[model samples]
Target: MKLASYADGSRDGHLVVVSRDLTQAHYATGIATRLQQVLDDWGFLAPQLEDLAVQLNHGKLRHAFAFEPEKCVAPLPRAYGWAVVDVEGSVRREAGQFQGPHQPLRAPAACEPALAVITGDLAAASDAAAALDALRLLTLAVDWRLDGDLIATHCAPLAVTPDELGEAWGGGRLQARLVALHNGAKLDPRDVAAVPGDALARLARLRALRAGQLAGVSLGALELPLAPGDSLRLDLKSADGQHSLFGAIDLDLAPPPALP
Candidate 1:
């Protein structure tokens, strides 16, 4: 099941179910209005959303519409927390700094690709296996840093349920390449060396990692310089190089404001 958030002026946008190929979508209107609501009640709400996804994918829904990435926000526009472990094994948890689609920002210094997981409520000390079981959705991420500090993190337009990856998701890791495109050219294909387990295991030590909280493991090393007016597209391709798993993080950074 693939899910997204359509911009609705509110902090949490309207929930949407996207097709596997990511070309179409159906509003999860009656099922749920926000992604966080579904995450809060996954056991009851997720299956319904899954059914809608099936209908949307098969063109059985009459109200399905074109999936527009430009009109998207972060999957969880207001997540409980955003915890990320960088290549240096440093873990940082902060209020979510997320963007989607064409949202522009100040010029970013460097862009690094990553894979993120949205996990359900997890108790402290939960091992990697347990952490894996709590995983809800998976998506691609781009870490845009300035002066070695995380300036922004762009999440792919759509997030898919872990099972959506099929064989690509195994051993608590997503066997995929975090592909970053600069101006339509491949800048770096970050074969995520920091697997989900690496981040999950580190996060497990925390007192509690609640639902609606996102965690990620960045690509081990490498940063692609992104200049002002640069366009960056971040997505995940199957390890075997078959297809795109998540939608994409298509961002364009605006040039810095002129001096007064």
Candidate 2:
């Protein structure tokens, strides 16, 4: 069970509750029986939970709580459908992958580490707004870093309708661009396009390209780990808002730190 507490920085009235399972974020209904079992086992406090409501909004469980904070215990809604659950369930050291209720994580296959931005359709209606919102959500970049570098900075548009986007952007086209900034110079954009039908095949090619480049780096691979403060900047946009995630890995090798 995962747990967190929040207060107005006060020692009293702090709310503490255990998050019983990962599936609760996806299909709280599917885990309904199990959830009851877990809560029951926790003793008297478990039964005290009433006004429990379920969330269908999407994203993490927080959405569930947000929908009706007072009336019930809401299960996390199935929001933008992006999840990066750790294998050990410890929420530490794991790869990132985009998952929708009906879509399998294997659709994109997790190999290189990644950061995924999930914006709903209203987001696409305002590309500039979506881009800025995506940036704000991406402060969690360190959680998605791999190989001492971030494999890809990406996005997933949700909620907003296609017609809404078309009305705003004047076309059915949306895009996210991530530039590699080195020594104050921005490198040309790398390809991370998400297309239909052969998207899987094309993504395979992109991964191959990354591997080949990483192998050939003359400075040797950046085996160093990223410090907590390290991060990469990414830009993203979408037209339909209902689309696959966008991502790109860094192939450039950073110069070694200066010697004393």
Q: Which lDDT tens digits does candidate 2 get at residues 111-222?
A: 2322322221222223333323222111111122343443432222122212222322232222333343332345454433321112112222322211001000011112
lDDT for model 2, on a 0 to 1 scale? 0.25
Say which candidate scores most in lDDT: 1
Best by TM-score: 1
Clashing residue pairs in candidate 1 are none
- Model 1 C-alpha RMSD to native: 1.9
lDDT of each: 0.80, 0.25
Q: Which window of 10 residues has the lowest lDDT sum in candidate 1?
A: 188-197
Count of clashing residue pairs in every prediction: 0, 16
* Residue 226, candidate 1: C-alpha displacement in angstroms: 2.2
Query: Residue 206 error for model 1, in Å?
Result: 3.2
Rate residue 247 of model 2 by lDDT.
21
Clashes of 2: 16
What TM-scores do the predictions have?
0.92, 0.24
lDDT of candidate 2 at residue 161, scale 0 to 100 = 19
